[model samples]
Target chain A: SAVISQKPSRDICQRGTSLTIQCQVDSQVTMMFWYRQQPGQSLTLIATANQGSEATYESGFVIDKFPISRPNLTFSTLTVSNMSPEDSSIYLCSVAPRLGNTQYFGPGTRLTVL
Target chain B: TQLLEQSPQFLSIQEGENLTVYCNSSSVFSSLQWYRQEPGEGPVLLVTVVTGGEVKKLKRLTFQFGDARKDSSLHITAAQPGDTGLYLCAGVGHNNAGNMLTFGGGTRLMVKP
Candidate 1:
């Protein structure tokens, strides 16, 4: 399993502002993914971040609202733009070292939009 | 897109009671994993069942994969208050791109002392 960490474990921001969550993995991995969990609900995948390329967003997720960056194998970022109260949720990152697939996750970033 | 349906959306029982949570899907999965999550924290992996009919145990928790590889279950013997949390099951298919996980609706369990 990979040791994953997310910066700014939590934050409170204004509705119109933007917040960027950073994810760092201890080991280099080929696949990294971002997810959103609404209160008392299941996780919804936001996108798959590929190193040195654009992110692949899931259905109903737009790049303009959630811009992702994966500059390298071990690091990625997901920025929530023009945030709204509906956007307040836990943002998590996961990594899978191989294709045979079980993913390890970061602690998660709890975001609150006021 | 594959979907996993989990049953018993909510459960509450005495500390000594036993219970089981089920995850069913029509689509086959290459692997399935169970996780436990507490309040205000990320989920911690409990176990992974890869092969059909596979069973794995950890302490008081037991996980079993269905023979068709499209279903799974988690059973707890002598449930404890410490076992109270959200239980989630995720499935991964062979054709899933980049290790994407299809998560179940989740079962919220509360064991009272």
Candidate 2:
């Protein structure tokens, strides 16, 4: 397990405003991922961030809406652009430390777009 | 897209009871993992099973992967109030080794004291 921390544990933002969430890991990792968990729903992958590369987003997600920055291996940021009520969800950051399919997650960022 | 189905989307039981959560999929997974999440927190990895017919135990919790690698089960014995939370099962279907994950609809468990 890894020690992962997310910034702005909870936030209330107005619609059309953008919010940036930061993820920091104690140890440098190779792969970092962002996920969205809707209220009462399971997690859905938003994007996969590898160091020195553009994030690969899932089908339902796009880079324009969720811009990701992975400037290093251990830290990354996800910006929710032009936020709406539908973007009100728990955003989580996770990392895969090894080749095995095990991942450790950080305490999520609870966002509410009013 | 690969889909994983978890049975009994909701489970409510009293302390000292045993419960099992099942995850099934038509597509075979390279590996499967189980996670438990509480409110205001992220999902925590409990265990991961890679081989077919493999079983792993953590204290009172037992996880088993089916022979065909398309299904799995998590059984908890002597459930306690602290065991209440959302249980999720995720699978890696592609051969990229941990690059991607497809999660199943979670099972909400409530163990009342």
Candidate 3:
């Protein structure tokens, strides 16, 4: 199992401000993913953070709003730019096991835009 | 678009009661996973069903995949307070490999003492 750590466990940002969340994995991983979970809702995949490449985002999401970067196999960052109250949600980073597709997730970053 | 539809969006029951959550889709998948997430924590993998008609048991939880690989179910026997959380089912898209996952809306189960 892989352990992941995310910085800024909780933050209160003013509207229009930007916040970057960092994810650091204890070991190298083949795949890393970013997810968002609204209060009382399930998790939604935001993008797939690729090593040395632009993240692949899902429908209803765009890179300009939620820019992501995977500098290496064990590290990635997600920046929520021009934030609004609606963007307040728990952001999580996950690392997938090499052999199977099982994912290990970070504790999560809870952001509340005021 | 691939989607997983889960039933009973919210459930509340007394401890020791039994309940089952369903996850269905029109598309087939190579693998399906069950996860339970607490209030402020990321989801924890409960079990993974990879083959059609597969059944896996973890403690008091039982997971079953449909014969067609288009659906799955989770049954909890003798529920406890710790069982209260958001239950989610995710599957790998049939056409994609590790690219994306279609997650069920989720079943929020609250077990009362």
Candidate 4:
């Protein structure tokens, strides 16, 4: 199992502002993913932060809206750009140390855009 | 698009009662995982079921994977107040890479004393 941490446990941002959430893993992981959980809804994968490469984003999500950076195996950051009230959601970071391993989630960053 | 559907979106039961949650999908997955999440916290991995028809137990919780690899279930025996949380089932598609997962709509369980 891997331990993961996310910064800005909770934040209130103004519309049109941007916030970047950081995720740190205790151990080097083979994959890092960013997710969004809207109020009373399931999580939706935002993107897979590839090491030293552009992130792979899911449909309905775009790089211009959610930029991601994975500089190394143990660290990654996700930026929610041009925030809106609709973007107010809990953002989570998950890591899988290896293939077939359980993916561990960070505490999650709660964002409220006003 | 792959989707995991969980039934009984909300469940409230008295302590010591037993409850079950179901997750179903039309797409086949290589592996399925169950997670528990409390309010304001991230989902914690409870167990991962890989092989078809696999059953894994964690104390009072039991998880089973369907023989077709398109469904799963979580059963909790003697539920407690501590068991009140959101239960989620996720799966890794056979064609997906980098261990990406598709999460099911969660089941919110509230165990009353």
* Maximum-DockQ candidate: 4
In the predicted model 2, the residue pairs found to clash are none
Model 4: per-residue Cα lDDT at residue A14 = 100
All candidates: CA RMSD (Å): 1.3, 1.4, 1.5, 1.2
For every candidate, what share of the true interface contacts is present?
Answer: 0.51, 0.80, 0.63, 0.71
Q: Can you give the DockQ of every candidate in the order shown?
A: 0.65, 0.69, 0.61, 0.76
Kindly report, for each predicted structure in the order presented, the TM-score of its chain A compared with the true chain A. Answer: 0.98, 0.97, 0.97, 0.98
lDDT of 1 by residue, A74-93 (tens): 99999999999999899999
Expressed as tens digits, the lDDT of each residue in B67-110 for candidate 4 is 99999999999999999999999998632456688999999999
Docking class for candidate 3:
medium
Tens digits of per-residue lDDT for model 1, B30-68: 889998888877788899999999999999999999999
Which pairs, if any, clash in model 1?
none
Tell me which residue pairs clash in candidate 3: none
Instruction: Report interface Cα RMSD per prediction.
Output: 1.5, 2.1, 2.2, 1.2
| Candidate 4 C-alpha lDDT tens digits along A1-114 | 888989999999999999999999999998899999999888999888899889999889999999999999999999999999999999999998986567889999999999
Q: Which stretches of candidate 3 lie over 4 Å from their true place?
A: B94-99
The list of candidate 1 runs beyond 4 A from truth reads B94-96
